[model samples]
Target: MVDTTLEGLSAVGDTTTGFDHPGLLYHDRDDYLGGARAFARAAVAAGGPVLVAVPGSNLAALRDALSDLGDAVHYADMAVAGRNPGRIIPGVLLAFAAAHPGRRVSIIGEPVWPGRTAMEYPACGQHEALINAVFAGRDAAILCPYDAALLDQDRIDDVWRTHPWMIGADGRRPSPWFAGAFAAADRFNRPLPPVPSAAATLPYVVIAELSRVRAFTAGQARSAGLTVDQTEDLIVAVNELAENTIRHTPAGGTVSFWTEPGHLVCQVDDAGHLVNPLAGRIPPAVTSEGGRGLLLVNQLCDLVRIHTRPTGTTIRMHMTLTP
Candidate 1:
């Protein structure tokens, strides 16, 4: 009998016939490395390999910890590989499937700085959607520590539905770039272009020219074959950031989006110094009716990179689109 009432809990029937229930394990208590080792052993014992994804710093640690498992463990560095989660996660799954044929593989997400809620970064809507699409039909498990404050019940459900198992390392603190780096590693051989730059001649502030920028973004998405939903999400992120340029800059800014193999890169350039240090990040308090624009942008974009100078501020965001 299965415990139907437990939150995020379900029993997976025998795999010999077919996986009865999608296996999901939600344990929020354990040491990350220790849990990883145990999981690796189990996967190997079950005639499958363990794929460990982590930052470069943790590579040595993971290798040493899982040394006992010998050929059962495969290590991949998400950071050194360039941190593209879309490619890495699915690539890892495909590799495992090829090697084991019928057996399921386990994924160990040993994120650095795992348990701190303050480290949680907002994932762009497109990026999250892309991840879901990649893991669409695979039997795998992702283990990491839980941040109760950073994750809500609904978000947990989303994770469970996407990942068969979620083990929470109680005291561990995982890094924010966990999934991003993994994706990058999977496509390491490809040359990732530097984020696009605009010419100095590009007008800093010209509200009349907004259409040109928006058109360029849409064109880029279309050329890249991004889904309508992903393109729209990216567009929303662009609009919010562009509006910020108008509101904050004395001179307007340039907004641009470019296509990568599996990403939509966007930038808003403004000739204004954000006098407010927390300009694009901090949302307005509930009692306050205004100031939520940039906050909303932050929530919508996967990653936000800010560059400010005497001339202006340039905000860069990345949204992953299905390939």
Candidate 2:
């Protein structure tokens, strides 16, 4: 219905347009390759920057197809770069778009794959939904491509709601399946599962107590067999989450850490409501006065789960343990 044209996007910068820019491009192998190549090449031909963030395999395929276009196309491994959906916006989408502010930038972001862990699927779903709000009226176009063969029908159903437009074999059209996108995102908002009984749990009442909490946690994490790098990441996440507690009343908060079969988890609880569901997920601008801490936490951890309410906010930061 809008500028969903992969062959060309000359109308991308037009302020007066119908429908919206974020569209769903669900495809199989052949369609994905052909459509993605055309999408990137078209952006280049129209003098707009194109960012392609997909898994490693797709990155390689698109690189080969668009290598001739020079710097018009940029690529990132979504598996690694977007492992944390919270980081996908500020880290991947906006970073590319901001670099070319004068023109309408195009992004092809593949967030969900067949192999995404169950623990990760919820946040990914929320991230896709939040994308609609993050760029609702901006001079940018994003086409989220879902793998039809790899993902189940239920997931394909979600793609229709998260994205307002669709690119099919018949060309682009407004998605009849789209709904109130942000409200749909709230369906995925949920509290993380309780910490395991084996988890090492502690409570700290004041900032002075945080140092002791950290020392205790470092020892426990190291004993739990966290690698040096993983340990550092865990500590950073812990410190940032703890720092947020300074704004709370003297009621204090709780901290928990544990090691699963092949993962390390650190969780923090505080009496603060996270009103903005989009907070931290979107990177703060260069001039942003605050809000960098949680963004850093998401980048350091392999996966993060959060549940916030009027009562409080609890966040779980996960790190993969190497054998």
By TM-score, the best candidate is 2
Native-structure RMSD, model 1: 15.5
Residues 125-235 of candidate 2: C-alpha lDDT, one tens digit per residue = 888888888887777767677787678887778787777766665566667877766776887778788888988888887778778877877887798788888777778
Task: Point out the worst 10-residue segment of candidate 2 by lDDT.
Answer: 10-19
Please identify model 2 stretches exceeding 4 Å from their true place. Answer: 1-27, 285-289
Q: lDDT of candidate 1?
A: 0.49
Query: Candidate 2, clashing residue pairs?
Result: none
Model 1 residue 65 lDDT score: 80
Best by lDDT: 2
Show how many residue pairs clash in every candidate, following the order shown. 19, 0
